[model samples]
Target: MPENRTEISELGEFGLIERLNQDVILRNPSTLKGIGDDAAVIEAGDHVKVVTTDLLIEGVHFDLSYAPLTHVGFKAVAVNVSDIAAMNAIPTQITVSIALSNRFSVEAVEDLYAGINAACEHYGVDLVGGDTTASRGGLVISVTAIGEAQKDQVSYRSGAKVNDILCVTGDLGSALIGLQILEREKQVYLANPDMKPDLEKYDVVTGRQLKPDARMDIIHELREMDIVPTSMMDVSDGLASEIFHICKASNVGALIYEDKLPIDKQTFDTAVELNLDPITCVLNGGEDYELLFTIDQKDFAKLEKHPDIHFIGHMTKAEEGKFLVTKSGTAVQLKAQGWKHF
Candidate 1:
């Protein structure tokens, strides 16, 4: 008889997280939130601190063949900041740790830091401290961001209620489409060294992939408007997958309108050029780094006039089940087929 063994693939990413978090206990009263939400909340004197961290492995999260080191550095910071934004907090500091192989030179590291510093300036965060180590495999970057918000203003994934309006910021699917384009062009170049990548027309999608701007602007705007979302999270995963997370956390279902999904014209056209369904890309594509949140029904009118925010759906009773109302008025079950590392 073989010794008992379980594969990580048996439990998907979320399932693995749940299983691993099952026995974990919060020992301190200051730990307001633990492993479930985007970031863990720690009680401070007057306000609360939201802390989140993200680890990016070279080939797994980014490909150096097409991805610039500068963009990678910036993206590493942005992703962590996006998690802080998900908690409805303003990021103040970040610590970036990197593991480097001899393949990189001092100039290369400087270029990477240039982007990291640019992101810190862009987001108004200070690079307090981090660790540097040697890597046997490839470059690895881990960023931990700390943000602040009043206890009353912090939003959690569990705060959404039935009938709350579901909102998403900016466009979706562009990053995925951009990634596809980069991979396609890389393949072309690998096949023939003489071929120069024609990436000018694909700027929007590629930019979304190379460097994603976290939705900190929306957080600031919401603060200005005095609107704290009932529930929120950044769309690091695909739209459908993220909706599933919100639903599971809030114990509610969602019914988003297909017509209401935001897809940029360039992304739509390029997806068709690649023989991909635009809507499916919007729903299942990941790495957009946009914000998906729910506002109380009464708060809907305030954000309605805002240009970037899109009202795509409303929360429903969990028993109602999650579905997407197609353009033809047919409700279809949503599948979480987004990015799967395993």
Candidate 2:
């Protein structure tokens, strides 16, 4: 190893972000937030604007062998929208940029745009503009989403107080399980060209991986019920990992119950079939795209009756430490093995 060189794996994704952020200078008064959150908050008169972007690269972020171009395009936009939703904001517009090689045809580009347009329609966000460029490599897509929220309505990752109820939207682990299934099928197809991909029974799990829906409906519901989360983020990097983020940002601790973790029947059964611990999948698998949030104890009842929301735990004092109480009455320190770009 060279004296001044270090591997990116040593720093990891969050570590790299932390190191990069050390040199950042937030000079503009209008730049309410620069980093360390799901989206950047900017001053926009009565309502603040939240902006977030995500890039998807072929082979790295996706495998085009099994992943349809359409799903890839839609997912590219959905992930960015998920970030805005994490901030308790409403998505209004998006700009898409794509780079492709000669291997892709005009029709292939159209298919990608079809899914992008569908997501735009579903989310009610306008596709205002984008850029098209040539790439020597595989397909690349970058989407930037802009959303709106009242200055007071926005939820920051650092706002959770001790004793706030921890909640998550939708079930977990299905996406990772789905990815596993997809990869398995890809291997099978590669080994035998005559064999067709077996994807019929795993539609639910597969769809969770391919076309995840951002929790915008819940955001709208929260607005209607006049409930703003004290702290919130999307479950893109697994449940336990996100809990650690909330704890670190809010300067608090957390205690989540094993039984309280939400796992879909299909996701659970498939994990078992794949010889994976379902609970482990729920804890460490990434890309669920569900909302993880904290609510004031007093505001819990306002959202208690919602069918999709699951109350998993509550915040604790900083000195107590973050832990997960097992179903067998064992209290263990929580671990974070979330998605690491490095």
* Residue lDDT tens for model 2, 23-83: 9998899999878899999999888999999989898888999888899888998999999
Candidate 1 C-alpha lDDT tens digits along 141-175:
99999999999999999999999999999999999
The residue pairs that clash in candidate 1, if any, are none
TM-score of each model, paired residue for residue:
0.98, 0.98
Q: Which ten residues in a row have the lowest lDDT in candidate 2?
A: 1-10
TM-score of predicted model 2?
A: 0.98
Clashing pairs in 2: none
Strongest candidate by lDDT: 1
Quote the lDDT for 264 in model 1.
100
Q: Candidate 1 regions off by >4 Å?
A: none
